[model samples]
Target chain A: MSALLTVEGLRHGFYGVQVLNGASFEVRQGTVTGLIGPNGAGKSTAINAISGALLPQGGRVSFAGTDITRLPPRERVGLGLVRSFQLARGFPRLSVFDHLMLYGQGHPGEGFWQSLTGGRAGRQHEERLAETALSVARRLKLDHVIDNPVSALSGGQKKLVEIGRALMAEPRMILFDEPMAGVNPTLSAQIAEHLTALNEEGITICLIEHDMAMVARLCDPVIVMAEGRKMTEGSFAEVVADKAVQEAYLGVRHDA
Target chain B: MLSYVIFSATTAGIYGLLALSLNLIWGGAGMVNLGLAGFFAVGAYASAILSLAGVPVPIAILAACAMGAAAGIGATWATVRLRGDYHAIVTLGFAEVVRLVAMNERWLTNGTDGLPGIPAPLKSVLGPQGFAVFYLCLVLTILVAVFLALRRLDRAPFGRVLKAIREDQDLAGFAGKNAMRVKLIAFAVSAGIAGLAGALYAHYQSYISPDHFQPLLTIYIFLAVTSGGVGRPAGAFLGAFLVILFLEGTRFLGHLLPGLSSGQVAASREILVGLAFLLVLHLRPQGVLPERIRPAPAQ
Candidate 1:
């Protein structure tokens, strides 16, 4: 399959501390790619640079053959690139149903004039979107608390809602930043299932996660990063077995 | 007596609208905006100028709202990239710049003397009695509409994204929300509402000056929202009412204390207002009407 996203020689830093150095990777279409590394391995930094949250000092990022290295985060989103955080962020004061509807409304109905006088068409569109969102909520098993504020949701539920929000954007590619962090076993399974299903439906995913087992289960190809650079890339089994990957995780042994 | 009560209530109602706008940015969206006075001043000046030029009242009101929205956009452009204290400082600077421009632009704003004798809406049709009633009803209607719209927005997904931005901006960005754009919009809407209130004030009072759009007025509205509950739309109304009541009710106290001069009474009122604000912050840090904490829906 053709590459959906390509990053070449990406470099980023904060206050003279280099976070991502000469990182290179490619995300294939309709595939789930897992990015794993130790703490401060620059996993999130790579995602930020690719998603345009942090501008890389040097490198190229092309999404579907378009250079997106300098595109703003919203522009990237407009181009069907979306992302989720390790820590699920929801509007605590907003209802779950409203959350979904807002994301759906991202397409066309949010303009001031449209919101003010879009009239029955707008209302009807919102209704249809809400209905569709409710169905998605049902699949996520978040149907009952649709009207509840996100603040009231458990940690895992918030993660599901975050995923739901990304789905609402109808993006072709989504970057998952530790979706399984702090989630329960049951919820983790549910998330894994959802991701698997999404991948089956031809959505491209780049997941930054610490859980190797979950990454192995859901991701087809795995990329490893160490100290702001790409250490290795292959099947999860191959990458885990690499001596360099092990040393990167466990540190250099004097015996070796 | 009824007239006085209605007048106070109507004034409070306009202030309530202003507070609601401020609450959206400061309380709901976690933006520390201090340029509200600028937006408010623009609305007041725009409406007053249009009315003096013989424009119809509805058109003048629209002009005022447009000016207010423009001011909002301006403020957003200035401070949207800034964070926390820096943002607050930029907004404060913008308010000062606006006030200075209003004071110096003699051709447009008539300098510090201000434009007076501006006609209220429907004045010819309603006369004094009818005009007061009509204008009060108009202002109240707008307030109600704003209240409803804000309430709806507060419950919607857009509001959720704003809250998410408030809690963790970086995370919100990852969640496909453009945090800067959202904050900018929130700031603009908040300023627009404040500007609308200024327009109403200009028409009702039939006069406006740079003095009328002082930074202190912005601070006073901030007090209302902070005391009422920062993020609650209803709290904005409650806060405004409480503020006006506290300020105006003390007039009776001045009358009771015959020995005190008018100047003394004014000074005392300021002192008391400050003290009351401190007391409220100490006692109910979240204000009188705290943000409603809705539970997560049942599984």
Candidate 2:
């Protein structure tokens, strides 16, 4: 299968130390691709580079055959590539409804002058969008708090809201950064289920998770990285059995 | 007393316009605009110069808004890359630069001597006796129009995106929002409104100087927004009224206290206004009306 997203020689660094060094990987279309790495590994940085959040000092990222190396995150989103942050950053002051309403493309009311002139047609369109937002909330079990400020939500709910927000964009692919972190087991499982359901609906997912059990269960053709380079790419079992993988994690010295 | 009421009401209306603009930027869009007076100065000077040159008032007002928006765009463009306090500091400096230019360029602004005899166009149409009343109505109408427009946009996708931008710009961008672009629109619009207010203020007062457009004016608007409720339009409106009254009510202290001089009364007024601001911040940090739980559903 053709790759939906490809990262070639992704190299990035902070002021002094390099975090991602020549990290390269391929995400197959419509697959739940897992990017797993140990601490100080470049998994998050690589995801950032791929998502256009952090521009890589050197590398190339192509999405759906389009060279997006220089595309801003906003334009990348317009092209149906969306990402969620490690900590769900919902607008704390906005309601659950506003969260989803803020998404989508070419909202009729986005422009000040257009909204004023849009009149009844505009109001009707907005009603339809609101109903859709409400239905989406109901699907996510967030209908109960649809009118409440995001600040009123629990951590797990916030994560769901984040995912819901990504869905609002009608994205072809979602880059999730630690969606399972700081979430309850039940919600985590629910999230896993939702992700699977979404994948079943033909949406591709790239997940960064510390939950190996989930990575094992959900991800296919797992890609592992260490110190900013792809260590190996294979099935969960095959990658685990690799000697380099063993050395990177355990630091176990082997004599020639 | 009637004249005082009309005068006070007109002043309050102008301040209300300024407060509404600031609230939209700082409160709604979540970007603090410390250089509000810069835009206001730009609008005032632009309108004053245009009208003095025999340009019609409407055209001059529009020109003022255009100049103000241009300045707003310039300010945001220069500082868009900065975050939080850095943006604030840069804008504040922008206002200072405006003041210095006005002060130094004696040939244009007439330096500290100020521009005098600014025509009150309303007086020409409505006649002088009821001119204050007419002027009051005009400013109020504008305030209401701006408030309504903001209220409509507040729920629209633009305002909703602004809310998102305010709370979390990066997340908003992640959802495909052009955060900077949205902010630029908000900043420019807010600045335009403030510029409009400055034009009205210059014409209403019939004279303006470099000292008229000061950081103190910006501070007053900030005080109004904080007191009224940061993101609430009605709160901003009410805030302007309350603040003006509170500041003006202090003027009565000179009359009440036998020993109090005019200068002492002025000092006391500042103290009281400061105290009220601090008290509001302490007691009702969200202002009288907090940001509402329910936003309009569509946006």
Candidate 3:
């Protein structure tokens, strides 16, 4: 399968301390690729660079074969590349339903003037988007609290809502940062299942995760990183069995 | 007495508009703009100059709004890249600069003397009292419309994006929002509304002066919005009314206290305003109208 996203020689730093050093990876279409690393392994940095949150000091990011390294975050999102936060970010004052509706409206339809004029096509498009958002909320079991301010939801529910928001965008690819962190086992299962279903429907996913079991179960090809550089790339089992990967995790020593 | 009440209400209504505008930038979008007076001064000057030069009143009003928007856009361009207090400082500096220009630019603004004999709006058909009442009605109508429009915008998707940026800017960018652009638009809209209020104030008072648009005016409006409720339209109105009442009520207190001179009473009144704000902050930090948490819908 052809890759949907490609990153090469990506390097970034803050205050002269390098965070990502010549990191490279590829995420194929309709596949779930796992990125695993120890704490401070630059997994999040790599994801941020790909999502256009931070500019890399040196590198190229191509999404759907188009260079997007220099694009602003919003433009990148418009191109069907999106990312979810490790911490679920939702409008504290807005209703959960409103959040989903807002995400749905992100699809280009009505400009400010068009919305003011009440254009027939724009209204029709908005109605459809709203309907789809409701359906997605129902599927995610968030319909019960649709009108509640997102701040009122539990942590796990917020994560699910974030996923719902990403889905509303109808994105071609999603980069999830620690989707299972601080989530209950039941919610984690549901999230994994939802991601699997999304991937089956041809949405590419690049997940950065710490839970090895969850990563192994969800990912087809897992990429390991140590100290801001790629350590190995292969099937989950082969990657876990690699000596370098094992040493990186447990720490290796050299004696005279 | 009723005339005085109406006058006070009209002034408070103008302040309500100012508060709402500030709330859009400072409360909704988490932008700290301490230069509101500068933009207000711009609107006032723009409308006053244009109207005096025989431009139609309505056209002058539009010009005022455009000037306010331009100032807002300029401030946004200068400080949108700066975060937090840095942005606030830049805006505050811009307001000071605008005020200085108004003070020194005698050719256009008439400097400290200000423009006198400015025509009251709708004075031909409605004489002084009638004009005052007419202007009050007009200002209130505009306030209601602006208030409802702001409420609608708050419920819309665009407002949601702004709230997201306020909660966490980094996450907002990650979710596909251009934080800077969203902030700029918010700032511009807020300034436009403030400008509209300033235009109304200039015409209602039938005069324009550099002294009218002081940094203290901006602080007073901020106090109004902050005390009323930082982000809500109703809060803005409530806070402004309360503030005006406190400022105006001090005049009545002088009658009860015969020994205190008028100047002393004025000074004491300023102190009272500060105390009143402190009391509100202590009693209700969320303001008179705290934000309500909406309950989730049933499955």
Candidate 4:
């Protein structure tokens, strides 16, 4: 598969504390790429830079042959690249269906005049989007609480809503920042299966995860990051065997 | 007595329009527009000036809306990056500046001497009593139209996007909704609504002054929104009327404090409004008729 997203020399800092220091990587078109690193290793910062949540001070990020380094988050989403937060964030009082429908593919029926008039075309578009939202809910097993406010949902369910929001965008690639963090093991397994199924459906995913076991099970060509840059990349076992990886994690020098 | 009642109702309708405008920015999109009085003053002054310049009343009213929208856009652009308390403070400052300009700019706003005998629309076509009733109908019709438009907006995708942004702007942006553009449009539309209300007020009263568009007026509208329901149009409409009634009802209580001066009676009314606001906030923080949307039926 071709590279769907490329980040070259990404450098960013917050108030003089450099978080991402020349981190570079590529997300291939048809694989679930795992980005694993220790705390403050710039995994989340890289995702932020790629997703347009924050602009990197120095970097060139190109997605699908277009330079999106300066594109705003909304425009990036329009180009079929979307991202999710580590913690689920959404409209507080809005129902799940409303939440899903609000982020519908291409933001249909959102024109100001069309909204005011409620023309037949807009209504038809809304109905179709609603149908899609219902199917997404059913697939995520969220149909039971589709009418409930997202704020009232369980943590795991809220995580699913975060994924569901990305799905509604019809994204080609999704950058997830710890989607399964803080979930119970059983729900984590279910989330793992959902990610697998989505990956099978041709959506590329670059995940930031701390759960090494889950990363080993779900990710291909896992990229290990340390000290704000890519330390190594290989199959899970191969990277695990690297001395540098051991030293970065265990702080023990493995002289070979 | 009947005429007084009709006049009060008309005034309430005008305020209802203002409350609706406030609700759109504050309740719909989570923007605290403390400069509402500034926009209101812009509309009133724009219409008054145009009408006094021999321009047609209808055209002048439309121009007033445009002017108000311009002010909204300008204010939003200037403070685009400010949020929460910062936004509120900046907007409050903007309103004060507008009031000061009206006070000092003698050539434009008459330097607080105020504009008098502003032409009332359709006044010459109808007798005084007939005009009052006719004006009431006109205001009512406009209010209903605005209310319906806002209701349509509440259920529409535009409103959904607004709610999304209101909840989490960054998340909304990730969802491909342009938060800034949406906010600008919302502000312009909201300010235009305020402007329309102001023009209607000027025409009905046949006079307007800088003192009329005080920050206190903005506070009253904000109270109406908070007490009724923040995000609900019906709540705002009813809240305005309810607030006006409260202000008017205090008149009867003034009789009980018979020894108080007229100034004290006015002060007591303000104090009463403050107490009522605190009571509502303490009892029903989400507002009397909190925002609630019925789920769409199963497909």
Best by TM-score: 4
2 or 3: which has the higher TM-score? 2
- Candidate 2 similarity to native, TM-score: 0.94
Candidate 4: global Cα-lDDT? 0.89
**Per-residue lDDT of A20-87 in model 3, one digit per residue for the tens?**
88888899988899998777778999998998878889999999989999998878888888888898
* Superposed Cα deviation of residue B41, candidate 2 (Å): 2.0
Tell me how far the alpha carbon of residue A106 in candidate 1 is from the true structure, in angstroms, after superposition.
Answer: 3.9
TM-score for each candidate, following the candidate numbering: 0.84, 0.94, 0.92, 0.97
Please list, in the order the candidates appear, how each scores on TM-score for chain B only.
Answer: 0.95, 0.96, 0.96, 0.97
Docking class of 1: acceptable
Q: Model 1: what TM-score?
A: 0.84
Contacts from the true interface found in each model, as a fraction, amount to 0.22, 0.78, 0.41, 0.74
**Candidate 3 C-alpha error for residue A92, in Å:** 3.4
Return the lDDT, model 4, position A240. 84
The numbered model that scores best in lDDT is 4
Worst 10 residues of 1 chain B by lDDT: B290-299
Chain A TM-scores for all candidates read 0.94, 0.93, 0.95, 0.96
The residue-by-residue lDDT of candidate 1 on A37-126, one tens digit each, is: 887788998998888878899999999999999987777887889888777876667678766765663534444434544455556676
Per-residue lDDT of B197-276 in model 3, one digit per residue for the tens? 88888888888888898889888998899898987777887888888887899878756777888888878878878888
Ranking by lDDT: 4, 2, 3, 1
Error at B100, model 2, angstroms: 2.2
